[model samples]
Target: MGDLTLHGSVSPDSLKEVDQFDGQEMSAAEKARLEQIVWRKLDRWVLPIATIFYLLSFLDRSNIANARVAGMQTSLKMSNYQYSIALTMTYVPYIAAEFPSNLLLKYVGPRWMLPTMVTIWGLVATMQGVVKTYSGLLACRFFLGLMEGGLFPGLVLYLSFFYPRERLQIRVATFFASASLSGAFSGLLAAAITNIDGKGGRPGWAWIFILEGIFTFLFGFTCFFILPNSPATATFFSTKERHYVLARLKEDGAVSSDDKSDNFSWIEVLRCFKSLHVLMLTPVLFVLGVTLYGLAYFEPTIVAGLGYTGNKAQLMSAPPFVVAFVVSMITAVIADRYNCRGFMIIFFTFCNVVGFAMFYAAKSNHVRYGSLFLTITGCYCSAPPAITWVTNNSAPHVRRATSVAIAFIMTNAGGILATWLMGSLSPAPNYTKATLTNLIMSIASCVLACVNLAYLWRQNRLKAERRQLMTQADEPEGMGDESAWFVYKL
Candidate 1:
């Protein structure tokens, strides 16, 4: 028999697909016990795979900064303005690629799609080393951005498919912490690789690209074996375990079980943009690009400007990221446990405000350097929760995918702005403009956090009141967050 479709839904018989077994006889406590066992198994496989892949993505993308300090500019004969343009070029294609890339990820299985992107971009990152002319470098970066664009949004969506909403932020943070891990690792690697200066007619900066890209490419092959498309397809699970996992997600209001969310829909993609949460969250993320990209692309440069020139500067940039990785994990636990993502974002961003204000006002090098810790803390910690916030509220696959994609699309645009803020023309020692910009972005993020929280709270109230009146057939559109059953996370 054909599956029964629901009104205003792409999915049919939401629970029927997962009700294959006699598990209905089990008590809630037994289900809970099994859920814990299944989740722990998933965590062992999922978190490490996602975190390591993200670390490579971040490393390959941001290692250019470390290479720059290692003499990429003088070796390649590019001017500072030209350097900044090269950075900006990466993001232009990056931003253009995400929306479509996300749609494709929906159409295709992430197991097949995610590793392919990493492998191709890893190759692109390798080719970045061999470019003789500035144009060649620009072309590599552009394609690199094109290949790498889908990864983050893809990974987030991939995790959402396996885990329920509440368990997500910390898992997201686990992978996202790899950004800071990359920062630290990239610095240490760049510092060591610089010792290979003039090897095989290549400068140390070029070697940084070669080695890291090769490693990233190799890692991509492993992802193919590691990731399963979804719980239904995960070979590691027993038949009973698989059905139980799906049932747990279904109970969490993940969506209609037979909804087949992986099947692409243009309507769902377009509909997500109209969401009030997506609408408001887009600009807030855009504003946050100041610190996010600023720290990623220029931490080495920023540290260098503070007086630890060359390799010493790269090494110095490593600590804050190390600190950020630890702090980000702790922050995720608190936010998850308390269910206060909105408050966590505001608190962490406010730290950036203080960090930037301190950086801008500091008289000594040490103090300015110390402030980098605070800036890294806020920039890295707040983002996982922020992105997950949108995904948590969104339903089915397409809406969650689009909502997540749009958040990053705008954030990548902010990446371009972040690139411009610290470009060659900025003041040398103080970088007063970048400082002021980050400070303003931090403060604005805090304000928007409050506003977004308040708005969601209001919507939750309205939904609660209207929920009783809602009929299954007359419920809100499947793609819409306006459904009485859908509560926006504050």
Candidate 2:
């Protein structure tokens, strides 16, 4: 009776006797109950507020593509290449700003920092609507990137505070999928807003910026009241439930305290350079980012290639994004459920490769449009898992932050490069070169996935052999040297 009683009780005395602390024997029922508590934590606050925050941020940042076709380019008298430069400008500060911002997020608390950044970016996005000259537009784009830079990588780190490693990929995927919706929704929203061109002597593109920015500002205010700072500071749960979560998280080797340390330095920055994992991950992310950003940078041009009118082209862009949004979510769920990030990534990249190849080969508009759906779907599908794979392998909180920052910076750099490469020269009917480049990038990404897998397998084998040797010897307690012994997953 005493042993049976331990199974259901949460008393300190009972908890101490329940089982080993490895998290290996948590029965399905216990896990289900814990998950219910976690869900309650999520549905009550996390998902709703995060969705609104990220959705608005993403929409405001990316909606410029939609706004350009609506009227911004014409109103500002910018050429196709110049508009591409404007799009590329936003990523410049974004690439430079994420690491420092994440450090601030850790110190100042996300509740204040995230909301403040959102409001600032919201104001900047609104200001973008008012820009009359090329220089004004450039200034606004740079500032917009500066403000929105840390939100995503910071969000990933923030989410780790709430979820275990196994579950984080799905949640991150879900958060990122919000960006996909921005793509899908921005088209529809721009379609409606573009009709307001003559209403107040303002262009339809200005209205796109104004309306989306207002929505973003409002969401930011809401986030101030709703976003939880961390598990340590969370107030929604009862004290015992918080303790339960913190203790369980510790059992899983996910406690963030292990990574916290003194101020950053060039030495810490150089640490990432020494890791083979970062070496392997950077190129994969670079190519993936190039392909994804190429698609984003050129979506409007691609849609217009179908020989549609302006508004219809804006509206037609919606379907491919909608397809990508759905496919990405499904891929994330499957990858997280089975812990199969590497293989799933390879599969999705293969799909992207084939999709891009089809776009390059197809001659007819209908065939090209069909390929757009496939290309967007498959390329977007691979991103979540590929990113999650990187995150899952990185360790220690500070090191993980450095690793993700490196990947994100490279990705943003890719965005900058793709913006130029897919410029006016490749517009419609002759975008075959751009499409072929995307196909090659996708194929290269698949090869990296295989290389990563093989490396991880070799590392795992080494780890197992070391563990066996240690067990066979008589070593003192607490003799595990993390530097020599701990090997990260691929």
Candidate 3:
């Protein structure tokens, strides 16, 4: 219950001593009580803000699809190819900005960085309503992507600083489930907002952007005052609670040497790139991104193709995502409780394969609609674990930041590819070719997940063997998953 002294900087050596003290001195019940207090505070203050931020981020990014159905494409005089290019443009800057933004988040701190970025993107999202030309729309979309890119990976990295690997999956799933809920909310909101189709001489599509953007901007500004940067700086916690937070994290092997350092290291960046797990896992995420983004961007349109149009199609889009949110949270809890991330990932991916295949081959509209539910459930459930896997394995703040960024960049690359792929499914009434392509991607993702699972199992076995030989003192301080005593959550 003693406080670790605070200073201008916390050295690795100091953190090591703190880690040792917390591990050896604290009794089991005392430790558990302190941990409960820390978790309750975090659940109250941190998780809700991060979840809401991401929900808005996704709503702003994907609301364009709803806008398109409300006649933005025709209003802007954009052809299918032009509209696709606008979507592609968003990913270009989005993919590029992720790594640098994550790095920046470390230096600037989440309190300032997250809300600032959200505000910028919110303004940009609002500007979409004013775009008179296709070029204007493209410009707005690109800027929106650039600003929004950092939030997801940044939140993931930020959450890592708070939670250990085993507990991280459920928290991440909760945040991700917000993204799914955003999809449902966006649909319902768009359906309602589009009802103001001709008010104030503006189309309903324009109104969608205007209203949602205003909501985002205000929320972002408010978050600047509310969100805490880290456990050390969080004002809501008592001194003892803050000490407990740091102690528990250190004992859980969550903190790292570079965590408090402002200096960026190229060596850490190179180390992330060289990791075999990261290299293999990036492609799996990439494929998932393709299907995920493609579906998010076009689910309304797809539902419209199934004989529902306008407001009804928008309303229909909500149910699939609602189902996805429920399924994702359930799967996340199971994955975390059982420590079975890889198996769960593979299982969900296989579900996607089945769903997509049915969507492609089924002759009945009801069957295809049911297939949407399956596909969304599978994709949404798998994503939290997939991203958490990278964060769970990568050591130190720098490597985790770089690895998460790289994974997202590659994944967003799939999104860039999806814009074109989904676009090519044009002549819109029936997207036979697009459905087949997504089916193929889902199958590929399942194959890769199986391969990755095998690799993780092997890695865990090796680590277990190594752990048997090493004494507790042999474990490296703040090395996270790379520590001799650390076991991969497989």
Candidate 4:
């Protein structure tokens, strides 16, 4: 057949039109097989490594919850308010560091920046173990936040360099699913580690931080060797294969060729701040962060209150994350397969609405426990699509980096709120204030999703209608995403 589509989306006409001077043309079947080979290579080398780093990132941050249940609060003599203060400390630097971090990520690139951030945060996480005083613990949390802040938005931008728009959600989801897996793994691992109480002059909660942090710290160095800076420099690919990868991205409108230019400027950062879409996205991202950190930093406590205790509560926490991981992957598969992003996001947010509602009102332990699954599923599934939506749409590498960073600030703000949500203040079981706040945030997120989708849909229509007059006549490398030719994946 003369007709062939890559990932069932890219067609021959657009491919040829965009890259008319491509080295050669092949039959549909030949092209399809080549793409499969390339994607497999990328998935093998890229996905797992990214997933690994993110898993550690999450584990180190959330393990504080595990520590709390294992007597961390008592050891440090922290009040609920004091504990909340420490939890909130991490996010302030985390949000503050994002803008500069985005600029640095662009200047240095992920190959170097990502591993460096991980290593520092990993060290900070390990320090969390050795903290003897409340002030000492607070300092560790603050620096940990500072170091870890950049990696997430950096990872989102990094993936865009390799994957096209149609294929982005699945790839983003695959690694983003690491958050859920990390949740599961953290609970299981914490149970085992915390059992070794009073080992080597350290409490059980201390080990939870020490061991996990050390592993994460060491793993960061390996990423420096493994991660390719960009498709252009990926050592695993032949020159020909590299060309094909770059061409595919350009043809798919995943990026403008000029996007690779090293023209990072303050103007680009300003544009991100000025972007209405990006601004609107901040509130949604804020809520997204709320749901995720709400569950993550507090789930162990939530489980402890649900008639489960000690290792049993930790064990119980794992299952919901496991389920969430599965739901996240499945949702991603469906979203990517249908080439639908916004609607899928809307659906996922609404799922969270139901989850938070049930979690707030349910009285039975079984019912309450079951609601955990819904909450995790909704939070984990929604993130990849949301990040993918922003990353896949923004153009000129600088703008994407800046937009994601801008939006991510709200996520850290949400983390700040989540730190105080339940904790010692609201207690456990019912957790009235926390539940009510989460419920309200979920409903707000749903509304924001609708608003974002409508805006995207309208933009898509306008772009489509004026398609005839669109041209890249102004800038040499292309006008970035501002070019009318750019297509939103909504």
TM-score for each model: 0.93, 0.89, 0.92, 0.93
Candidate 1 lDDT: 0.81
lDDT against the true structure, per candidate, is 0.81, 0.72, 0.82, 0.79
Give the per-residue Cα lDDT of candidate 1 at 325.
96
Per-residue C-alpha lDDT of model 2 across residues 120-151, encoded as one tens digit per residue: 89999998888889889999999999999888
Summarize candidate 1's per-residue lDDT along 122-186 as a digit string, tens digits: 89999988888889999999999998888888888778777777888999999999999899999
365-424 per-residue lDDT for model 3 (tens digits): 899899989888888888999999888877666677888999899888988878878786
RMSD of every prediction: 3.0, 5.8, 3.8, 4.4
Q: Residue-wise lDDT of candidate 4 within 1-490, one digit each (tens)?
A: 0011111122234467323335465667766766887888899988888888788888888899899999999999998899899989989988888877876765567788899999889899999899999999999999999988887887776777688888888888988899999899999998899878998999999999999999988899778888877777788887667777877876876533332333566776677677666776778888989889989988988998899998999999999999989888888888998877777777878888888788778778889889888888888888888888877667666677778887788787888888877776577778888888888888888788888888877887887776665444432442455555677777
Clashes of 2: 0
lDDT of 1 at 186: 92
Counting clashing residue pairs in each candidate, in order, gives: 2, 0, 0, 0
Q: Higher TM-score: candidate 1 or 3?
A: 1
**Predicted structure with the largest lDDT when compared to the true one:** 3
Q: What is the RMSD of candidate 3? A: 3.8
